[model samples]
Target chain A: MTGVRLYFRYLGVSFRSQLQYPASFIMMTVGHLVVTAIEFFGLWALFDRFGSLGDWALAEVALFYGMVHVAFAIAEAAARGFDVLHRHVRTGDFDRILLRPRSTVLQVMGLEFQLMRIGRFTQGFVVLIWGISKVGIVWTLPKYLLMALSILGGCFLFVGLFVLQAVLSFWSVDSLEVVNLTTYGGVETAKVPIAIYKGWFRRFFTWIIPLATINYFPLMAVLDHQDPLNTPLWLSWLSPFFGIAFFTMSLQVWKMGLKYYHSTGS
Target chain B: MAQIVVRDLTKVFKVAHRKAGVWQAIKGLVKREYNPVRALDGVSFEVGRGELVGYLGPNGAGKSTTVKILSGILVPDSGLCKIINRIPWQERAAHVQDIGVVFGQRSQLWWDLPVMDSFELLRDIYRLGPVDFNDTLEELVETLNLSAFLGVPVRQLSLGQRMRCELTASLLHRPKLLFLDEPTIGLDAVSKLVVRDFIKRLNKEHGTTILLTTHDMDDVEALCHRVMIIGRGQILMEGKLKDIRQRFARERRFIVELGNRYVEEEVKGRISKAELIYLEGNQAHFNFDPTIVTPAELLHELSAEFEVRDVLIENPPIDEVIARLYEELAI
Candidate 1:
């Protein structure tokens, strides 16, 4: 109970701090909204011109885009400290975090709750609800639960990616751009249906990175059809678990990186 | 048992040697080389409760490294360090609950928020109860003179005010031990005095054991009862301030002024061994080796020979003594 209350207090302080510069906060929020909207607009233009990708329709693509953005926004808003770990490490601010009585993970999570991402969050949410209304399918309770879980799972997955990115700073600070190929690049690539991609790429996203679990499997479940690749019916429901597992594994890696950091004094 | 103890602590860092240029970065990834830098090599120290000890060393001399290890921020590669009966790294969360740390170069206070907000965040971070938190807050605000700046954003506060707030934030939980690394660096003389004075009062009143690492010798002299000189990852000397000076500065400085400006003449006997540090016409300053002669005898000899007007004696600067001690010990 105390821990939960403390977490809320941490968020409250972060919100107040960000609010100190209301104009900058508003500008950044709108900028994120505009920036994220461009990607969806590009997708909409492509669909309007060609009509569909393979057999996937506009609403199906929206589902993929909406779900992934929701996950990314949550992680971007809630786990921003991990995204900016390099700054903290370079400035030796991470040392102060260690001095605190709280766990480093919890403390870093509480480092910021970027209200700026709300711009992107609201945009993604609007697109999702719009897609839901336009699809015009019978919505069942289990499918609804799976939809919610998919978003939750996606949140953990991206957070895990952010954690991995943060862990790399413990060693070398250079080539951080390469790690971005996995995170921002992953989000960009995951926007499309997994079926349109080649076999190896599909396998990589499905079994390796598990991008399909967050979107395609749940989408297939919602569409009430068996996936052509014969991935088990239950597997789509487990998409969120991939993210959780990946995040847990990344946390382990993060701990190992911390140990290495202590030994190396970096 | 000591409140803090370390046995043969050592920390070695492997620095990756990276090649320059885009092409080199690509090639270097496949075949990288690493060089090892030993930061702390077989270092040892022990501190008792309520003892304000100064940990001094030159830049890159492992001063901050030692403080980091003791405070549980970093782990030593090969050694045993126990603070307050706990291994700092192994049980970090528990270990840090009773320890407060301040890095003067950085402000732990939230940069954009008011100082009071930072304090409240710290209260939550440490999970102090309402009554205890209020009590500590009220006492700290009054003693540290933070009322004028508490409501102001940390970014707007002057360096001195920010430092005072930092001190209050760190002490709100009332930890048993406080680790201050360069807590007075880059502050005005008044601010430095305020920080030093507050530290003195805190130590005197609360009996909080403090291990202060600083480049400022005055802070050491003013606050620390004992000083430890470290260099090259080793303890060179640790003792009372007076005792360390006596060991290094074996001479006493003597200043003399004549009734009138006159041609300088060489003095014989005890004053000859004394080095002439300064000479302005009739007024001359000589630093005599105390082992060979005493201040009284030297003054008597100088008074008897020359038509002296006034005389004054002083000790060498502690910084010079410490420098010489470091050289002598090869620390």
Candidate 2:
């Protein structure tokens, strides 16, 4: 509880610092909104031509897009410490964090609050609510709870990916573009049903990175659609569990990276 | 029992040697070689609680490596080290709770946040109770004269102001031991004096044990009670600053201005003992060993022989003294 409280305080500091530059904050937020909107429009155009993507309707895809972006935005806002890890490494600012009498993970998570992501978050919420209304799905309390859990799970998974990217900075200072393919590309690929992808691609993301567990399987249960792959009904609902498991494993990697930091001297 | 102890603390770093040019860079990925660089070689030291020790060294002399190991930032390959009955690397988080570190090259204050906000954040990080937090904050703010800059963002403050805030941030938890690495680097004369006075006060008032590292000789002279000079990952000299100066003290130079320039064949006693090093523009530099010839006696005899206007004594630089020590020790 104390850790969470202190993290909130760090977030509060970050938010206030961001608010100091109102104009820049608003401009970046708007830019985020436009960029995300354009990506969604490309999906909408694809649906217009094909009418649906491998048994997935536009509303279904919107549901996936909205949830992934929402989770991603939350992670981006909170895990920006990891996002700018290179700057901290180069400037020896990480030394300051180490000197503090707090968990380094919490301190880094609270490193920065990108207020500009509010724009992407706001747009995601609008798309999510619209998709739910248009899909005409039966809403039960458990299903609603599952939806919330799925978002949380997705947020944790995305944050894990961010953590992994940040840890790689210890070895190489330059941020690689391949990591973005996993994060940004993961989001793009998850929007559609995993069935749309080839056998190799689907297996890679599902088994290796586990991107499919956040959206595809959970959406299947919510939509009451029978999956051709014959994954058990209980297993489909357990998609979020995989995300939590992966996050726990990534925590070990983060610890190893920290030990490396001490040895190398940042 | 030693509050801090170390034996044969050696740290060897494997650094990948990279060649210049794009083609060489491409080739490096396929074939790379790493060379071992020993930053600390069997270097050892011990300090009792509440003792303020100044660590001095030239650049890349492994001064920081020692500080890092003691502060639990790095682990030596082979060494027995402890701080307050705890191994620093093994019990890093616990060991660091009672220790504060400040790197003069870096600032701990939040760049975009006010100084007060940074302090409040630190209070939370340390999990200090409201009473203790407020007391320490008040004391630091008052002693450091930080009330004026409390509301200002760190980026907006001057270097001196930022440094004060940094010191306050590090000390918010009231660590028993403080490690200051080049804490006075780049400060102006006034700021340096204020910092030195504050450190002295911090030591005397709270009995905060301090270990400082610096290249500035004045910092050693003004603040350090005991100085340890290290070079090539080894201690070259360690003793009282005044005592070390006496050991390597050179002949003092005296520049005399004559009322009138005269081609004197010889001065009575002055020419006999002193080396008249330079003579130009009605002035001369006399290098005289104070042990051999008293400066007063030489000045009086020289005045009797020639008209004298003014005289000034020059103390050679402490850097020269340290350089000579390095040559003698081959460190």
Candidate 3:
């Protein structure tokens, strides 16, 4: 409990520091907002010309895109510490974390806050609301709970990927592009339904990274949307948990990698 | 009883190496090579309770490797390291609770936060109590003279002020053992003295065992009771500072000024065992082997030849002494 409380305090401290220069903070947040808005608008234009993607309208596809991006933004904010692990390892900043009495995971999590990700959050949230109005899903207590869980579970899945990338920093500081593929690729794949992709691509994401379990399956239950996969409603409700499980397992790998932590740079 | 003990510590690092040039870079892209560096080889040492020892070495002589192993930050390939009855690497979180560390090259403080804010964060990090933490902070701040810039961000503080803050940060928990890696590097003369005095006091008062690693021989001369000189992954010398100086540096410096002014040629012939190093304007400098000619004999020979106004004999500076020692060790 104390560790968690201290982690929150560290988060607050990081946020305040990033806000020290108001002009810079506002510029960065606006920059993030504009870049993501333009990217999403490009997708919107593509759907505008085609009218519908295999009977799935832009609004229907927006549900997946917005939810996946929303979860990613939250994970990026929470795992900002892991995002800079490469520099930390190369520069020997990781030694400071080891010297502390707290858990290494908590210490690294407290390293940064990345408050500018709020721009991405805001854009995704607005799109989610827009998608909700167009789709007109029947409101229920369970559906409301599933919506919250699906987003949070998706956040954990991305957090797991971030942790995995950070673990690779221990062995080699230069080769990180491959892990970036999984995280960004996971977001891109989970945004739309899996029907568009076939064969190995679908299996690679659904079984290997397991992003679809937390995002696509849980989201389908919330939308009452049918798919070719024919995943049971009860299974979809339980699939969000697999994301949390993946996060737990990734932390274990992080522990194993720490033993190989050959500290560098004096 | 010894508070820290290590036996046969060894570590080898596989460093990927490539020659310079675009062709080499392209070759490295295809096929890479690694050079294994033996950072530590069968090293062994011990520090008893409250002993402030200096771990001396040239660059890349495994000084930091030993410190890292002792502090539980790095795992050795094969070794037995027990600190306060616990293996550091096996019980890192617990072992670190009783130890403090300061890396002069790195800043543990947040760049944007005030000095006090970082201290408060450390308080919660070590789970220090409100009353105990305040008392320690008050005493450290007052002694280190940090009150003037306590509220300023760390980036704004001078290097001297930053070092003081780093010392305070490491000691907030009152750790039993402290590892300071070049703590006084790049500080002004006055700051150096202040830090040296504080370290001496911290050891004497708190009974803290300290392992100091530094390039500044003045720091070692001022603080360390015992010194260990490491070279090429091995200890070349270890003993009391006085004994090491006496054993390695047996040459004495002699200077004489003649009573008759502007008699540069007053002493033409050299003394039996003394070699004149510099002679100009009625003053002469000679370096004599102490075992062959005593200071009194050299002075007697000087007065017999020229009308000596005064005579002075002294030992060489510690920096020169250690430089010669390093040359002899061929590190």
Best by DockQ: 1
For each candidate in the order shown, give its overall lDDT on alpha carbons: 0.85, 0.84, 0.87
- Which scores higher on lDDT, 1 or 2? 1
The alpha-carbon lDDT assigned to residue B285 of candidate 2 equals 77
As for DockQ, the candidate ahead, 2 or 3, is 2
lDDT for each residue of candidate 2 in B126-245, tens digit (9 for 90 to 100):
888999999998998899899987999888998888888888988988998999998888999998988889999999999888999988888777778788888888777889887887
Clashes of each: 1, 0, 0
Any runs in candidate 3 off by more than 4 Å, and if so which? A262-266, B26-31, B259-269
Prediction RMSDs, each to the true structure: 2.1, 2.5, 2.1
Candidate 3, chain B, TM-score (2 decimals): 0.95
DockQ of 1: 0.75
Task: Give the range of the ten consecutive residues with the poorest summed lDDT in model 2 chain A.
Answer: A169-178
Taking chain B only, the TM-score of every model is 0.93, 0.91, 0.95
Assess the local accuracy of residue B202 in candidate 2 as a C-alpha lDDT between 0 and 100.
96
Give the lDDT of residue A252 in candidate 1. 96
Per-residue lDDT tens digits for candidate 3, residues B194-223, read 999999999999999999999999999999
Comparing 1 and 2 on DockQ, the stronger one: 1
